[model samples]
Target: MSIRPTIETRKAVPTMEGAGVHLHRAFGFQDPSELDPFLLFDDFRNEVPEHYMRGFPWHPHRGIETITYVLNGTVEHGDSLGNTGTLGAGDVQWMTAGSGILHQEMPKGNAKGQMHGFQLWGNLPSAQKMTAPRYQDVQAKDIPEVIDDDGTVVRVIVGEFWGKTGPVDGIAADPQYLDISIPPGVKKTFRIDTYRRAFAYVFAGQGAFVDASAPSGVLLEKEVMGQEVNIRDMSGDRTLVRFGTGDEVTVQAGEEGVRFLLISGAPIEEPVAWHGPIVMNTQAELQQAMRDLRNGTFIKPAH
Candidate 1:
């Protein structure tokens, strides 16, 4: 109940990633303290196979967790530990970098070369930076989808929702990851943990997120009929909406309806030293991680 007044909204920046893949970067590499315990979010979406085929080559991650969610196409991934899998539409993979690891993800489009997905980077505390790398691959079929009487659907991926807990757990940030959709002209407000920082990313269609205490970007939608009046404050798809403190969030879907990912997590408030895929507390720890990687012993011994 002690949540502060609404904070200013931070819009997603248009950026490219993954070998010429077009995407929007929500935030990264600057003022980590603003979003303590959580580092970055990227919305990678494309309709041309040639744009995404290059994919993400083998890369290293050490002190962070990466969550990948596929919306339309298929993403085949492999890690240094020999784990391999494919994530189809709606599937999620939460990978903990822990000590260190090498991973690659290749994207293949749907029938029309339509591919859409997102990746979020969650930071790990210093104590858990080397606590054994692991993964929770949540398949699309296994994710719990709850339908409200009003035609709203929600898919819980990382935390609890309406008394149901997500399959992925034991995370340092105790995050709540939800994919939600509201039917045309429906207004819905769902409860979120007031203690955690929360944000939403609009992926499909358009909507207005509102609340009396909501930030300025909280828009008012007025259209002639069956048309989406692109609110001047928000971009089209791949727009990231960061919310202010509130137990409940209200959203009104436009004529085309709206689909978005709503996520929240408790702030660690701990020091963060980040470089590339690795994050640690002290510079010395980061140096050690790099040295270990160079020495070919970054992964901890199997117990």
Candidate 2:
């Protein structure tokens, strides 16, 4: 099994969105091809209620799917289709804005006034761009979790892993989203499909994604003889690690352990015409979508 090499590792950038809500963007509004079939990823976490309570007000999305995973707190959401629900801690809501949809998400903090969550936008292929809107709201209990002997825990959120499959399926990207945590001083390797594009976002503790074959100048931290070495190369909190071609990824947890989201998806490799929340294959199609919104025809009649 070839170990995927770390191509780049960078910290998530702070950004504000949706009526003054504060969040950090891992990747978005840049080169979409870097993570094809995936458009944006935002980490919305705050201890101050004022920073996130305003939430994402009513917004329209088309030609894409938005996956919201709540780590703490709750997100009350309502869509144009009359679908309404609340996503609490560990809950996941996958919304497909195939043709079009308008939705609002209001976040509420927990008892300590802390809110944390992630939202990922996945692109829909041209063929299914205008199919139909749908939702897959999976409760925390319905999702599968796998535990290893060495205290490695993995929550399968969107695809199969460790003999367990996620509750949310039928996604166009066929992506695998996993929340993984490793015990301190543990070394582990994960297998990913060779044809898929994969990345890891570290949100807790420090670790080194190691690959002996990693390209020149790629730094990595690893323990030697029970002594932490190359400490400067450790990746910690809110770091985004992008991997090169391979079928496996290896990581060594630091003294405090490490937790991260490991995500991978098949590439769409299609043209993307994007604006705000709407994504299309061509500029003309994007123009048509705007015209539809202007003419009150953005929401297609249910069949």
Which candidate tops TM-score? 2
Tens-place lDDT digits, model 1, residues 27-138: 8888887766679988888887888899988888998999999999999999999999999998999999887889899999999899988899999887888888999998
Whole-model lDDT values for every prediction: 0.81, 0.92
Per-residue CA lDDT of model 2 for 69-143, tens digit only, reads: 999999999999999999999999999999999999999999999999999999999999998999999999999
- After superposition, the stretches of candidate 1 with alpha carbons farther than 4 Å from their true spots are 1-6, 213-236
- Candidate 2 global TM-score: 0.96
Tell me each candidate's TM-score.
0.90, 0.96
Candidate 2's C-alpha runs over 4 A off are 212-229
Model 2 residue 87 CA deviation (Å) reads: 0.3
